[model samples]
Target: MHDPATHHKPRIAISACLTGHSVRYNGGHKASDLCRTQLEEHFEWTPVCPEVAIGLGVPRDPIRLVGNPDHPEVVGTRNPGMDLTGPLRTYGEQMANELDDICGYIFMQKSPSCGLERVKVYQDNGHPAFHSGRGAYAQAFCERRPDLPVEEEGRLHDPVLRENFISRVYAYADWQRVLAEGLNRGALVNFHSRYKYLLMANNPQAYRTLGRMLGTLSKDDDPLVVGPQYFSELMQALRRCASRGTHSNVLQHLSGYFKDALTPSDKSELQELIGQYQQGVVPLVVPLTLLKHHLRNHPDPYLQQQAYLQPHPESLGLRNAV
Candidate 1:
């Protein structure tokens, strides 16, 4: 089993209000117990409140996104002309430039300055016209680091999204470590090989596309140029949540490696467990446990090396929820 405490915890950027800080416009906190308690052991958080950083006081008037949903202006709800968009964007850009070590971010949902998605955009007449706008700081963060895994507090409540977010965070950290060690064609290829099944479960098309990208690498190719493109695609691939069907496909593929080693009864039992998982009759942990059991007995080198079997720390119990 992977010892999480022995591994380096990924640095994560989190909204200050979510960390139990009284940084909200109403002078209250929207403390997420999950972040403060559950995830503390796994993540090192860097709390930030863009509004507060930009000189907005606690208990300040609430702000809203106005005008175009795609490019909304941030302004005080009580005073339309009181724009904070410029200051927030400036702060966001600065954070993006400086927070290069952050592997992921957790934003407060529906925040005018920090929401990840579906923040309300009001019309000139003051009616909420749409929920299509993203928060100013969140938008800037995305533009700056498209590779980073980002999630809203509300969305993280879902088991699948929560699992996916943590998985990506760990994966991104691993990629960062790889780059830190000096990325070369050989190192990149080895990295991709380890994540093969994981990428397939999330998005088979992207998995194949990335494989093709790896195939194009040459001894003379520049790691500096190729590394960015590879990671960009890898992150985008991971952004697509792994579905039951896709997971089943990967599981079945893994099972094939042990087909010759298993008896008729063992094979039947494994197939049934995978079927139950695909049908949502049981959590993913069931089939995965069985697979690990067989893997221990069989010990195929390829399957043993694959990251899909243990993407993140098991202590987190992420698979149990999904």
Candidate 2:
């Protein structure tokens, strides 16, 4: 009975340049139409430019990661002595605490200050190294909140990664809401119940392992201890993009709920659609929509509450791509 129209949009942190702010080293924005326009309808954004926040001027000299890839230093390309490594790391730590309320972050790709991965590191001779390193600011920020969902703008163009990221964002937002309401054994069980099929689709082994952890809890157990472990495992499981085979497995399992209600033709049609989806003839939304329609007619309370049925806002059309 939940209406997404009334649901609060999850708050997100994004690179300021992606929001059309001219905060890049060249003094121009790397504006993302997908984030600034399409996704804006579903998420509240907190634009952050770590470079600018660290007191770098617009149109400033570009910086590069140098020396060891594992512990590279952020220094100006034109002047090696102009190191901003400490400042960027400091700002990242500060923002990680400041933006605690945000459920997710979208970083600018290939940015020396914001790229999530595969950023170039330079040698003493100014040649790019064989191995790449993450942005100093991004490395520090993620270290502070490893469980928080994050993706780069470039990676978002991949439909599967995009869907997975959005799904994780909403799931994290749900966990945030649960924390706000205060945690207990019953609340934890209920949260896990809703994500049952979702977790299974993403990681079958993790789903069983997490369920057993909760199943073993007693009334005397502390939510403070159990909650963090459960949430951490849950987020990690969701990080994996569910394969078509896994999704089809979940769909088959879901169909079992209506076995007694569906007519022979209805069952046949549903099975056909699922097969097509599994074989990649159609997107996941096709089978998912049909299942939803049948559920509407049959009305099973347990099945109705599953988050897998509607992971993110349907308006986002995320399932259509996957």
Candidate 3:
């Protein structure tokens, strides 16, 4: 495994077409400017065109999913006899193993072989049966690495989803570093501590649940046994995007650390900003920027270690929207 924590740029696997490669069936690209420019600056990209990798040439016949949505078959749209489901599935599995080190993946939306969700599966009569199918290769790849962060390029346009996806990718990279350094009870505990506020904002129940789970660990207990379980739960918790209410709660908690350092007037200002954030009067960045400034002056050791303060690069400006 390529240990992403040791690498300067966290590795990301992306759909080739999204990167402006002429890999689509029509010999054109879906090119996402965000992926091609913005994200490309911070992360290393590994483009994969499963269709092309499966020996399907550019400008090849378009394919569609058919039969049971849960186990759809990828077949040519014009001629159903041309099936590529088996090859695509095999290739996905192979790549999953090869790209085990990648911190995340960005799939092309609505693709019969890359769409992450809601792909249309047609009936035998050429009518759309349901829109619940997953792309053949995507389904296989996701099953192989359910813990990995993944999002369709289209979904990244939504600020909240984009922020969540990027945060999870960085967190996943951090976890990979822990694994590379060797997992132990101490390392696991420290990792959870660093993400305390982050987990609370996203899923408060998970924060408590995971805390108790770790608190129960004895020196005799094995991290190898608990590491996978803990990570699975943590990732699942992150999938639920934090609401404004949750964010307000977390902001208030962070504000408490500055209670003594802040005078009555400064405290009142901070509270008003948090209240405004809850009421949707301002974006999260406004209050967060203030909180960070206070932390810089007051400088609490624990507060400084919290990943919530800087979940992703400030240059991304993800918090400005939500």
Candidate 4:
């Protein structure tokens, strides 16, 4: 399997249409400017259009999910008998098995074969049903690797979701690196320590739960068994969106490290910035930038090592909008 950590740009899988490829049924692209321009520098994208890859030609008949929302069949919109579900699922399983190094996936929204969520499902009468269905390939991929960070391009427009998705991608890549090198108790402990604050901001309960699990690791225990369990919990925790209160709590906790080094004015200003962030008066970048500046001046080893400080590259400017 390829290891993304070895590459300068983390590998990501994206819907071909989102990359401006003419792979849609209408032979057009649903290009995402952010993915093509802003995030292009940070990630090496592998575009996959399940419809196209499954031998559905360009300008092909449109398809829709029909049957139970939870287990729908992809069939032609004009001719319900023209089913394409089997081929799409086969292609998805093959892609999921092959793309083990992909750190994240960017799905095209509302696609019958790639949307992450809420893709339309039609009834037997050819009328639209509730929007509770996921794309066929997307469903297969999620089942294959639930730990991987997955998001729809449209949802990435939301600042909070975008930040969370990118953060998860970096964290997942780091976790994969640990597994690739060798999974040992010490490495796992160090990984958890670095992500302490980041995990707390996502879910305090999981932070404590995972810490306790790591604390109980024994020499007799198999790392392969324990590691999967830990990762499953970690991914589930990250899916919980962090709120302003949680972020403010984490920021305050981080500020304590520089309390002695900061002057009275500096301390007051930092607290004020954090307060503004908590009250939604400012984005997280404001206080985080100040903290980063202080960390440079004071140089606390533990604080400097925390992934919460720079979860992803600052060049991505993810926190600017958050």
Candidate 5:
């Protein structure tokens, strides 16, 4: 969703491990230059390491979950059950609050302290579950900002998952923009409108849900509903599903909308690029690059207004890539 030409950008929180920070328990870094080279030009990143912040020393014995999956907490098993519950929970709370502009989180994979998915859960008998429940710190972070996009680095390698992550990040940023102005159904509609095509691209169900929400609009009504929170939960659910897919399904879905927007010649040219991407001869961004270029001159104001596809100029590295 790079739209750097429009001067739109977002701020995000990412684990230090993903940024190549030596904040891991192993004293090594797993920096993602995908972020360093591509996204660095657009987003301002806030780095965090819950394990280190809780007084865990570098190269220390690793930690794991040790209770009910829902309520299980983190601890250093070899250190006679040193609990990191309090500090991690508190820090997550503060991090959530302090992150004024944060729209998403990119965490390290399989980290007992930071992994968002597939973390090894230990049983009472001290056996591994070989799956993730969630990390204590990451769980708290999600709890605090359920509307924010959260993805583990490993899952992001999946194109569908990656698209979903990107969609949610931009959508959350859109929500932030709406909140900054004032909460209204009009703002909500506007927010959904921008993301309409993007959702249609990834998840048809999500697109329809949003369409129904938009249908609820009433001129004299207050767009925001107070507690019992129907509207509130709706927003949360949308953000949660923003990332989920295989690129093939999503790309096929999205291409439908763009078919008529392109001329026969334009479609042919774009198809060639897409063929290259599908065959892995070119990266996924190549077709998106062309689609974005043509979208600028698209006759349909409605399509152009779907800002979610091209959320910010830097989304596709359009402005900064050159």
Candidate 6:
């Protein structure tokens, strides 16, 4: 069980409909299974339905954007007149300000009021003019805080995006914890140490880069000159390490997780699977499946102790899944 009081919690903003609440444009919900898993395991959610929050009642007629996007108005189809621009924009600003600690956001799909991208923008005569517009609240939210990681539920279907989301969310969450607790040199060293293996599995280039970076933080290291830009520089480098890079690194690293214990037959099978992946005949998951199955027999206490490999998702694929 996760003890919220003892552990550092990430305050995440999620669309209310994704939590199985009926806050959709048509008074329905589109809860996601993976999202629910994350909700239960991690995250302290601050649910918001912008349209509902801005005084648009549940079961109300749906609204769509019309005219110039720079000055679009929300008009209800049934009424032909429900201007919610002022209230919606105002509420968005309020939420953005009040929810200062929200490290990330998960939005619903393709909604004019909540979708993060590609929403329909209608013309003055209610004809569809364009299919590239963002939600009112989402635009406002991003405008207010451009640094935060934001993802729409539809996009999370991609494995690479999902991996990136998970990694970035955890990184942001951990950084906030470090900020709150005030990391000392000793703690920072240990923190970096704990992530060493995980970094290797996720992204070796980044892992090696981080190791090299840490070497500069010695006792004689001058943070006064670099302190202002240290963390930003570190993360920016990490951001360059692609999902493909990490997935490839992870496959190679997991090979070490079972290097010593596999039987001759198992070794041959693993070898064959890897050969297939290398030859572009098989997906990376083939070898990973064998590893996960092999893990059942030769359980490493230390491997299980690590949080990164725990609860491994079979659903995710590397470049193929992406």
User: Which model scores highest in lDDT?
Assistant: 2
Q: TM-score of predicted model 1? A: 0.97
Once model 5 is optimally superposed onto the true structure by TM-score, how far is the C-alpha of residue 271 displaced, in angstroms?
9.1
Q: Per-residue lDDT tens digits of candidate 2, residues 130-219?
A: 999999999999999999999999999999999999999988988898899998878899999999999999999998999899999988
Residue-pair clashes per prediction, in order, are 0, 0, 0, 0, 11, 0
| Better TM-score candidate (2, 6) | 2
Worst 10 residues of 6 by lDDT: 310-319
Q: Cα-based RMSD of the predictions, in order?
A: 1.4, 1.0, 2.7, 2.8, 4.8, 5.7
Instruction: Compute the lDDT for candidate 6.
Output: 0.66
The TM-score between candidate 6 and the true structure equals: 0.66
Order by lDDT, highest first: 2, 3, 1, 4, 5, 6
- Model 3: per-residue lDDT, tens digit, 183-290? 998899988988888999999999999999999998888999999899999998998899999999999999999988999999999999999999999999999999
How well does candidate 4 match the true structure in TM-score terms?
0.95
Off by more than 4 A, model 5: 1-5, 226-298, 312-322
Candidate 1 lDDT by residue in tens digits, 1-322: 3233456999999999999999999999999988887799888999999998988898999999999998999999898889988888888889999999999999999999999888999998878985579999888878988889999988988999999999899889989988999988788888899899999999999999999998987878897889889999998999888999999999999999988999999999999999999999999999999999999998887787677888888888999988
What's the residue-level lDDT of 70 in candidate 3?
Answer: 92
TM-score winner among the candidates?
2
Alpha-carbon shift of residue 249 in model 4 (angstroms): 0.2
Q: Global CA lDDT of candidate 1, please?
A: 0.90
Off by over 4 Å in 1: 1-6
Indicate whether candidate 1 or candidate 5 has the larger TM-score.
1
**For residues 269-310, could you state the per-residue lDDT of candidate 6 as single tens digits?**
887776677666766556656766777688875554343443
Determine the backbone clash count of candidate 6: 0
TM-score of each: 0.97, 0.98, 0.96, 0.95, 0.76, 0.66
